[model samples]
Target: MSVQEWSADAATEIVRAHSGVRGALLPVLHALQERFGHLGPEATRLVAKELNLSRADVHGVVTFYSDFRTAPPGRTVIAVCRGEACQSCGSRELERHAQHSLGIGFGETTADGSVTLDQVFCLGNCALSPAVQIDGRLVGRVDADLFDRLVSDAAAR
Candidate 1:
């Protein structure tokens, strides 16, 4: 996608203004993600060029940080906690159920672009293990049916 398509003039201006600062990766990346919801290839290349850094450098940072996204987000973010606590509480099973119900694997957006499924190491909700978060709101004791219900609700909204 083109930068013009995703970024507002304000977002682009932010990128340009900070591109030349030393150790600017984290800040610039945060601003870009805040503006566009995610960082695409075009944005990375633009940032690299503006900052006098290699595209690989930009890409590396993005990939290294799971918080950075290379594609646009869906209307709702469905994050499954993969932390040890959640894992012990059947988080993996819940993850599979969510993926199947959504028809999209982890780190992928639904075809309708309504939801994005992601994996998180922890959500600090271990007591409610096997938890799911939609738009940052935690839902505990997630099962296949519950997962379906959440997706359906998000679609309706």
Candidate 2:
């Protein structure tokens, strides 16, 4: 997870690269998020201006997509599955443990900026219910201890 600091110049370049293209908003947003780890107000403003759209319009899209982040993420992002299958498999307990241990709820980063907790609907691993995606790698049948170990390993990286 190599995230660059957000800068107006860098954002403008990214927005311009996707300007005038069909359905450029998504690509522009992805590029910006990829570079900065998240899209801030300034990035949204530039994107809206360049795309000839209202700031509200851009904001709506950002909010509508779970993949987009409005704030910087921690060095390691931990995503737990919240789909029906996962829930039925004791994922709810797992999620509670995570939140309690991290002292933060979903969509928030730890105070130390080492871990971020998130929830995804599914990871296509229903067979192994209670799946978790840590730093983009999917792990199935996750429990509290496994999650802690994974998070610890991720932080050490």
Candidate 3:
């Protein structure tokens, strides 16, 4: 669903669905985000009230986790690995090329709403350093040419 279609009632239902469990905060947040694509202020407040926790508590958790998004994602998410292994293999240059090629930095989406660039600590492809993940699929041993082709393919999608 679109961000414009998110409702408090739906958010509340999600909270109620997970309220009977132990340590419901993370699950509830994940549920809300799954349903709405992102957790907005309304859902955060509702979750806080339902769980009897401060809004700050909920907000803090959301902000602290890179997986949680306060806004909607683009059509495709490209996560470039920035781990020690990847960095040692020219991931820094890859990152700079991505920023320049996409006109957006890590954690930001392109203006046309086709791609969102993110930085991941690792993708378990240390052997194939300088890895990148496109739409949840891992691509390793990436260079500038490969990165450009991936970005182009994602934008086309």
Q: Could you say which candidate leads in lDDT?
A: 2
> What is candidate 3's CA lDDT for residue 5?
70
Q: Write the per-residue lDDT of candidate 1 for residues 26-84, one digit (tens) a residue.
A: 99998888777889888888888778889999999999998998888888899988889
Using lDDT as the yardstick, the better of models 1 and 2 is: 2
Per-residue alpha-carbon lDDT of candidate 2 for residues 32-150, written as tens digits (9 for 90 to 100) = 89899998898889889988899999999999999999988898999999999999999999999999999999999999999999988999999998999998899999999998999
- Write the number of the candidate with greater TM-score, choosing between 2 and 3: 2
Lowest summed lDDT across 10 adjacent residues in model 1 is found at 1-10
Candidate 2 — what's its lDDT?
A: 0.91
- Give lDDT tens digits, candidate 3, residues 1-157: 4344788887888899986799999998888888888888987888989999999999999999999999988988999999999999999999999999999999999888889999999999999989999988999899999999988887776
lDDT of 1: 0.83
Error of 3 at 124 (Å): 1.6
Best by TM-score: 2
Query: Clashes per prediction?
Result: 0, 0, 0
Q: Per-model C-alpha lDDT, please?
A: 0.83, 0.91, 0.90
Predictions ranked by lDDT, top down?
A: 2, 3, 1
- Using TM-score, rank the candidates from best to worst: 2, 3, 1
TM-scores for candidates 1 onward, in order: 0.80, 0.92, 0.90
lDDT of 3 at 138: 95
User: Stretches of candidate 1 above 4 Å error?
Assistant: 1-5, 16-22
User: Which residue pairs overlap in candidate 1's backbone?
Assistant: none
